[model samples]
Target: METQELHRGRLIDHIQLVVRDLDASRAFYTAVFDVLGVPMGGTADDYFWADELFVSTADSEAAEGKLTGRHHLAFQAQDRAAVEAFHKAALANGGTDNGAPGERPYHPGYYAAFVLDPDGNNIEAVYHGEAKRSAPSVKVAF
Candidate 1:
């Protein structure tokens, strides 16, 4: 292993999710992502893309029903305004808000909003900028 490769930008390219029903998951992601102006990679089962990164989902066959844990997926937004738009769109598309758009001082200026997809997966939109001393904290009711 020479390890001589140099990376140009962000390393992550895509993320795949396993959902119980592909159709429901696809609708949820499409609607929420559409609000953020992310295009759906047309006619490819259940797949959506933002820039060069793609997020896809497929039917899961674990046989134990929906898996539960702290697993979550997050996307970086262009700005704080984009994050807020995503939150509003997600809620309108039947996604439950887990956390509203705001800064998490504990995480070093992490402005993010979280929503639970149709399959109960936690999805987040984040914008990381200059650190701030005080930022409002929002607790989601649903």
Candidate 2:
């Protein structure tokens, strides 16, 4: 097998969103991820990625020309300002506002923003108050 390394969040290893319009999705995600401080992992004619989220055209080999159903994916933000910035950047790049930046009842300091991506997937950026992290993410190699 080919050697590889990955950085992952606590629960999910990665998520692949197969979209009808790869370009539109890429644009939307690029802007949002930029504001969240997540760099694009890599890209190709039909796909792109940032952190653990992979986006692709249905025509991409792995997608087998099948689009995935709408999904709710949330990203962690460093602070409330990042969440607000994520909303603005997403809107300017083909995203629709689902919920503007604000605190939610989910918990104290559960500030977040939600947007519908090019394919209507519910995307969120959240900042759960100030907290410390032992590590940014878990790393795996093979």
Candidate 3:
């Protein structure tokens, strides 16, 4: 089995997204994460993961029941270029364009791109301009 780690520093330790098709979700996420520079953690018969995100099919024990419904999830990108790469990658990997990459009214310098995954999840990549962080993240191995 491939070992992986998750960063722990926020209110939510982790989030599991139950997908209808693990293979499709995996391909979609694999492409997107590659642009974001996040490594694919591991995979099982019914699930696969990347960084802090866990994606499993409804048949997986972790899901317990049904697949997840439409949801909006925005991942932070290092820069606007990364956001553009994310959109291009997602589209090349079975994702539909929800919104083109551009600055939004959400806030100044909030350049972002949006796409719909195989399961219709509204996934986004946003670069909040330049900023300083104390730490990239709190590493937590599992």
Judged by TM-score, which candidate is best? 2
Clashing pairs in 2: none
Task: Quote each prediction's TM-score.
Answer: 0.44, 0.53, 0.52
Alpha carbon lDDT at 46, candidate 2: 83
lDDT of 1 by residue, 1-142 (tens): 6655543432222343555566776678778878987776745555444565444443232211333323356776767998999999999999888889998663676798878888777677877775442523333332
lDDT of 3 by residue, 108-139 (tens): 89898878899977677888788787887788
For each candidate in the order shown, give its overall lDDT on alpha carbons: 0.63, 0.78, 0.78
Any idea what lDDT model 3 has?
0.78
Prediction 2 TM-score vs. true = 0.53
**Each candidate: RMSD to true structure?**
16.5, 13.6, 13.0
**Candidate 1 lDDT (Cα, 0 to 1):** 0.63
Error of 1 at 139 (Å): 39
> What is the per-residue lDDT of model 2 for residues 57-129, given as tens digits with 9 covering 90 to 100?
7777644354334665777888899899999999999998888999987578989887889997767888889
Candidate 3 Cα RMSD after full superposition onto the native fold (Å): 13.0
